[model samples]
Target: MGHVILVTGGARSGKSSHAEARVAALPGERVYIATARPEDDEMRARIAHHIARRGPGWLTLEEPFDLAGALDRTDGRGPRLVDCLTLWLANLMFADRDWSPEADLLIAALARQNSPVVLVSNEVGMGIVPENALARAFRDAQGWLNQRVAAMANEVEFVVAGLPLRLK
Candidate 1:
């Protein structure tokens, strides 16, 4: 099994940067499994910014869904960085696709990986309760997903103010 690291934090907390560095430290070509979709101008700009920050030496794969399949395909190639799970979850939810089965598949794939994987996820449960039902539901689902991944991860880090605090 590969070394699985989960990097989580609030928005703008530098989770993606830290996760990228973790994957960059490993040997072989760096694979970036980007989950974000360029749905609008703002999102496209954000994606561009990430691409610019990463600079080069990355084989980027845009997989808004089927993350498990992406991992399986990239497994033996190199260290992969899944840049943010929150957007993946949102994509599933907004598209009316059942996310539990996909998440389960991801966990199974992670267990069988042969190369290192660094995953970025947002810590959304730290703030006050959301007002809308959909927002609350998303929060609950994100918390559950984070817990499950962290439990299976070999190492977990919570980033705050660009600092990664090891949790496991």
Candidate 2:
């Protein structure tokens, strides 16, 4: 079984950087599973910047959804980093897709992974509650997802102001 790491924090809180650093310290080839979909020019540029930051050393897997399927296909032969599950969650919500089954499948897949896996997510519940139902629903789903992953993770870290505080 593979070791699971969960890195979560507010936006721009250095969660991705901390998660990448953890993966970099681990042995084996790195596979970055990007879950962001560039729907606009700004988003496209942001994605480009992220890809450039990782450079040529790591293999990139552009998985906007179907995270469990992507994990299954990768075979978990090397260290894998799934950055920003929050975006994946948003994708699911916006598409009116059921996210629970996929989240469960991902948990099962993580338990069976043959190599180390690091997951990054955003902790969005610390702010004021959203006035809209859809936003509230998304917030609830995100919190649920994070809690589930954190429970199963071998290590969990919360990042704030570029500092990581280990929770498990």
RMSD of 2: 1.1
Per-candidate RMSD vs. true structure?
A: 0.7, 1.1
* Candidate 1 per-residue lDDT over residues 39-65, each given as its tens digit: 899999999999999998999999999
lDDT score at residue 70, model 2, on the 0-100 scale: 74
The per-model lDDT (C-alpha) reads 0.94, 0.89
Please tell me which predicted candidate would have the highest TM-score against the true structure.
1
Candidate 2 structure lDDT: 0.89
The TM-scores, one per candidate, come to 0.98, 0.96
After TM-score superposition, the amount by which residue 9's alpha carbon in candidate 2 deviates from its true location, in angstroms, is: 0.3
Instruction: Write one digit per residue (lDDT tens) for candidate 2, span 142-163.
Output: 9999999999999999999999
Lowest summed lDDT across 10 adjacent residues in model 2 is found at 68-77
